[model samples]
Target: MRNLRLTLAWAAALLVAVSPLVNAQTTSEKNLKSDKKAAMSKETLPRPKVIIFDVNETLLDLAPLKSSVGKALNGREDLLPLWFSTMVHYSLVETLSDDYHSFGEIGTAALMMVAETQGIELSYDDAKTAIVTPLRSLPPHADVIEALKALKADGYKIVSLTNSSSVGVETQFKNAGLTEFFEKRYSVDSVKKFKPHPETYKMALADLGVKPEEALMVAAHAWDIAGADNVGLQTAFVARPGKTLYPNADKPDYVVNDLSELVKHLAATKTAQADTESDKTLAEQLAAQAAKSAKRFPESVRKVYAEGIETVRATQIEESAKQVGDAAIDAELTNWNGETVKLSELWSEGPVVLMWYRGGWCPYCNIQLRAMQQNLDKIENAGARLVVLTPELPEKAKETAATNNLDIVALHDNGSAVARKYGILFKLPAAIVPSYRDKLKLPEYNGNDAMELPLSATYVIDKSGTITYAFLDADYKKRAEPADVIEAVKAAAK
Candidate 1:
């Protein structure tokens, strides 16, 4: 009996000793899994894409090229256009064929071709120095500094990219007074290849510690945009006058005519980011509710409005337009024509088309009015009355209407008081005011000399004065097309 009890105690001691090892193994496994999960959590987090600006045509103005090339070719400015065209074309070819060449090489080739055609004395080295040196000294576009400052203020890490070597890039930035505007400058020198070559872009991004998806390449060249887009980098095309966009091919995520437009787009994108987060939160709430009551309802309907909130917020277009409609706008005073017309009075019978014009002095406004005049019949047929509103004095407005041959009613909304109420009026920048006053010859606002109304905005207001459709573009050169107006009118009719 003594031996049996001793053996039993030994067995219990043995079990106790082995049990700790098992528990230790289990705890170690649990810790390993937790560490793995933490590592994965970091890996899954998304990083912000680096926004890269192409230094040449995007931020810098190349108008100096005309005179520079004219001198290089000995008084033939006509050869200027062809040189730039061929330079861009061959650059793309070099990249597309998986071959890399410096921008200087392409520029030399283009200049030689132009020299041969024009019978000018030019050598490869001369062309290279002229093109590359000018690039190092070109001025930033008028809107560049303000726009860049705004982007930097908005917490976006700005980068400058160029086919030039890092040395060349630094010289360019220093000359343009833009050195402080960029966090970093990426030159193709490290990769020893020009852009459009995936290696060049990839290496630059890798150096920045960012992935291609988290980067945006801004350029004025369509091929540059296409190449950037191909490699998974978002693209912004700055449509400078000498440069154009590829409308059909791999379109850029954003197209802006100038740097200011890009800044505005970025601001809008920031707003959209907030909107998207709100939408995601709403979706999460709905999903949680759906999970709670799985058996009571079918999956699809339950998924849509599963929460206590019965209404699913959808983007309502014409419905929202009809609900608020547009408010009746009127001038506080009448013109020399003795017409004191309430804006709503015109729309009561049919849809009233409203156009805001700056003045006759504005070439952009003139072009827009001409476009509207051309589509007068279309406007009339759409059961809409066309009215042109201007902050200009009555006489100036009349002169503008006569010059444009507009049959539409002209209403004078002096000082843009009505415009201020509608949230569209803004003071002209100090820089633009002097240029507009001296160059465009526009008179000052009645109340405020420093302020002026915008170029033009067209709106389709329903009979109830609610704006069914509105076109508000800050750019003067662009206007709502006749087709868009017709569509808005038809949409309102339905």
Candidate 2:
């Protein structure tokens, strides 16, 4: 009862709504005291600072769990929010009682309680399976994958700090196709405590060998931000419901409306920092090379080295901004697929109609594919080979092709590496994050877990890789008409 009171007190103090949970472990109470002490050890380490993440309400999606409950309760869609509140409440109860309960158990208990509250009849086993299965396989928000990729590329070490057991978090990470992005996943089971507990946050930072000041904490819950702030970690709040404003005691350093906004903000920050560092490094390298050349030859080489440095700087700037040469007319992409057909090679044989699509999840791609299918005969008779290049996983790519009933070859362009080489690769905008999640509901990129976007382009390439005709659409929804490609093919053949 004391434990329950402490748990409720903590929840009420933080204005955190919560549900009930399973019993705690034998050693949890003793462990909690040690955690506070353990967290006080602020040691700095050698590697770049690690940013610790909160998993469920942070990186991983709880929407599936909530959605399932809402459906189970017959439009009492608010059941999930209530159940989640109880889950957190019980997690604290376990910690205070010096006990540890697996997140799965706590989740089960919470679901049963929520069901009882709603006067719904569900057997313990049935309720547990319904809630836990989806929780275990919960997807990450769409923006999460891309945001992590950008951070990884920018040299930030990423880790997940969650109240879920390590096994639970692992299952979730793997299921969400997010195993690669996280350098480490720490579960509260390690400390036998949940967040708002300074020890839990401390242990995570300690393991990563980063000072709290150097680390940033991101979560969709206000309690998480407040707890993180108490322990001195900078927090970014992602406004998940029932998590109100910080209690005036702990304020987040940044409050974003959604994961998309957080991702864009982080990307811009990293980019600016990178540009600054790159400029410094470039200046130093040029100066050192110039000095070496001056020492090597007092006459001719000095001017050459100076000229080389200038050329290098100019090259960098041009490469940064220069668009690819009319991609349809030049820069023929080689086809490595075993098939004897290549996009450019086909053009010389007759005419080649190439489509650059963003893979199957895109509504625009589907609409365009159906249109292309409608004009298959016209395309073929015009002496053109139709090919679609996408960054989908091979199986998914094949499935998408089969579903579209396409006669064209669906080529795999995994990593968008081919598109990048062609200067068609661009970072996805944060604005489109919801479009991918709530709208298109696409699977993440196979390699990086980031959302994939392609500039829907159609090209007519000749046998020599020279593009004869091209269409580039800035709006992904509107594709080049099959008639347009057919006309281009006929014109090229003539």
How many pairs in model 2 have backbone atoms within 3 A of each other, for residues 3 or more apart or on separate chains, i.e. clashes?
15
Q: Return the lDDT, model 2, position 10.
A: 71
User: Which residue ranges in model 1 land beyond 4 Å of their true spot?
Assistant: 1-48, 92-101, 282-494
Tens digits of per-residue lDDT for model 1, 420-472: 66655655655445645653445542324645564366778887767888776
Error of 2 at 386 (Å): 57
Give candidate 2's whole-model lDDT: 0.64
> What is candidate 1's CA lDDT for residue 239?
85
Per-residue CA lDDT of model 2 for 307-411, tens digit only, reads: 543543343432342232344433333232434344544555766776788866553575466567667788888877887788776665664555444556677
Model 1 vs. true fold: TM: 0.47
- Per-candidate Cα RMSD to the true structure, in Å, reads 23.4, 18.6
